[model samples]
Target: MKAVIYGTALQWKLDLRSRALLITCYLVPLLFFALMGGIFTSVMPEMKETLIPSMTVMGVSMGAFIGMPTSLVEIYGSDIKKLYRAGGIPLGLSLFAILLSSFLHLMILSVILLVAAPVFFGASLPESLPLFFAALSIFTVVSLSLGAVLGLAARNQSRLTMVSQLFFLPSIMLSGIMFPQNLLPEPLILLGNLFPAAWGYRLMQGFGIRPLLGLGAILAIAVLACVLLWRRQAE
Candidate 1:
């Protein structure tokens, strides 16, 4: 437990220095929120009600789908895996550290969006702060779990980038963040449900049962995939 905590702390500090982590987790997300927060509020006018949650989902998705996987690839896709084994370090330590560090980073990003959205664009706050954060944490975990699978499964950075977009782009477009899910065609709505972002956005808005079930299912499947990929790498 001590080692895990120490490793996570170290990883967080190291991630702070990583250009890719800084870009994906902080820069792009904040810029998007700043730019889109204005446009959405101005164009739709009604978007103020859900602006925070929408932008938060996009930011978290980018960090998890794009940022987190890069760190994992650096470790598992290279000689670092062998180094960890030879140095008496548990292979899972790296995974745990990276995920936890990313969770913290993403939560910070969410909080920033939570604060900034209201101040900058007059976005309405969620009715319940505690419930909002609870949902955000769950969504972040599910996202990072999926990212872990990508990171562990991809053989290299190029492949990770190509595949990460498959998750990230759909998340932004179909997640009801940009627009209402009902505006989308029936097939698109169903397809959007396949991604965590849609369910997560709904969950943040205080919708019940179905979104929880959807996110829960995604989390379970993603964690299982991560386990299987880790085992494959271990072998």
Candidate 2:
């Protein structure tokens, strides 16, 4: 337990220093929020209600899909893995530490958006703060679990970047964050449902069993993939 905690803390510090993580997780997201928040609210007027969650989803997705996976690929795809084995560290420890560090980074981003949205854009807050944060936590975990799979599965950073977009672009385009899901075509809507971002947006708006179950299912699948990938890398 102590080792896990120490590993997570050390990883957190490393992530803070990583320019890629800082840009993907913080700079890009916040810039997008600052720019798009005004545009969305101005264009739609009604978007103020969902602005916080929508932006939060985008930020979290960027961090998990783009930022976290890069770090994972560095650790698992290179000589670092051999160092772990030589140092008598469990392989799974790296995965856990990265995931936990990412969770904290993402949650902090979420809270910043939650606080900034209303103040800047006159966005409305969720009626239930506790429920909203609960949903946020679940969404972050599910997203990071998927990131873990991508990081562990991809053999190199170049491939990871290409593959990460396969998740990130869809989440942004089809997740009803940029626009209403209902406005999209039936097939597109169905496809969007396959990603956690769609359900996460819904879950944030109003906590419901369906969104929870949807996210739960995604989380389980991602976790299973991560476990399998970790075992393969361990060999």
Tens digit of per-residue lDDT, candidate 1, span 8-49: 999999999999999999999999998888999999989999
How big is the positional error of residue 183 in model 1, measured in Å on the Cα after superposition? 1.2
lDDT of 1: 0.94
Stretches of model 2 off by over 4 angstroms after superposition = none
TM-scores for the candidates: 0.98, 0.98
Candidate 2 worst ten-residue window by lDDT: 226-235
Query: Could you tell me how far off, in angstroms, the CA of residue 192 lies in candidate 2 after the best superposition?
Result: 0.7
**Pairs that collide, model 2:** none
Model 1 vs truth, CA RMSD: 0.8
Q: Backbone clashes in each candidate structure, one number apiece?
A: 0, 0
The regions of model 1 sitting more than 4 angstroms off are none
